[model samples]
Target: MDKKKPKKVFVEGAIPPEKIAQSVANHQSKTNIGAHSIFLGQVRADEIDGKTVYAIEYTAYKDMAEQVFHEIRESAFLKFDITCAHIYHSLGKVNKGELCLFVFTSSARRKIAIKATNYFVEEIKAKVPIFGKEIFEDETHQWKVNK
Candidate 1:
């Protein structure tokens, strides 16, 4: 009998690029996929209503976040004939211009890869129970989401 490996989806406390890359490689190794799409979300120091963002502190309702992410993975699998998917989001303080979210999807063709990548990122941002506190350069802060 052939065994299937488990997929990884995490609401982590701070993830490095190397770790995410390793996870992507692991998922790719499981199938003979021909395309891979990755999206990396970075914190930016920008002005909001006259305030400049200095950094961001991320937080999540972990259990719900994980559950939502899992559903996204399942939906991606059902909607697209893909090889695998992974999502990793940081849970603590992330400095400006630092990576906070990473999404990787691989498939047998480029069409599905592109579609699934877009769908994955959109769904996660809209549905996941993750929150971000944007710190202003003047020491003020506010919670932010994809607008």
Candidate 2:
């Protein structure tokens, strides 16, 4: 069964802090969910060749990314006893210290929620065709890869 529909997961630029708070508020009424786990991916100021990264320009094949995201969510639902899940990823320039991706999962127990959140993060990193161009302090850039 398709327990959930394919939803828009991409956000422009940086993922705002308030978005996280709002998500919590939105689910407060879902009393069945006893535990919630959230994973926030922040752009790091990675130093390389005497330069520090100031921002990251992200891009993706949107249609394919969405399909992959949907498939991941469906698999997670089957693998975990989760009540709900949500994901948001940045599609443009995100500064160091700003959030780039957000993955939230809710379940009746701590273990399921925690594991599902980790699964979602890992799947996104491995399966999503997201590209990040690290822009350094000196305006120089380099391609980024998840390590």
Candidate 3:
């Protein structure tokens, strides 16, 4: 199952816009990749119990989470004819509208790339033991579950 030495997929904070752009730029050299798909997950300001969410504090059991990510990575490549894939998720508090997750997939065809990216995202959401605490505007908080 050692396809690629389980890439480091976690970023220290909210993923910066520049980093996303750089990811695209870095792939320009891959001439064989005809298409690339990207998925970005952002914190949303949702009103819950008369309070507005301001940010999300993300946490995870690092070793287990990474192992889950690794399994997902291998599964994705096995299921799709993807040329490359990348996943990044925030490790700390990320404000509303800021990026918390980034998933990229590339292939010779657009459909495969898009499909692989979506599959990776679903696997991550359903399998990863990552947790998020939604912080409301008034400092109240609640555990977040992906919906």
TM-score of each: 0.86, 0.97, 0.96
By lDDT, the better pick of 1 and 2 is 2
The numbered model that scores best in TM-score is: 2
Give a tens-digit lDDT track for model 1, residues 17-74: 7877687667745668888888888888888898889788888787878878877888
Q: For each predicted model, how many residue pairs clash, with residues at least 3 apart or on different chains?
A: 0, 0, 0
- lDDT per residue (tens digit) for residues 1-147 in model 3: 555666688898799999999999999999999999999999999998899999999999988898899999888888999999899999989999999999999999999999999999999999998999999999989999788
Which residue pairs does candidate 1 place in steric collision?
Answer: none
How high a TM-score does candidate 2 get?
0.97
Q: Model 3: residues >4 Å from true position, as ranges? A: 1-4
Error of 1 at 92 (Å): 0.8
Cand. 2 Cα-lDDT? 0.95
Better of 2 and 3 by lDDT: 2
lDDT of 2 by residue, 113-144 (tens): 99999999999999999999999999989899
Q: How many collisions between residues are there in candidate 2? A: 0
lDDT of 1: 0.81
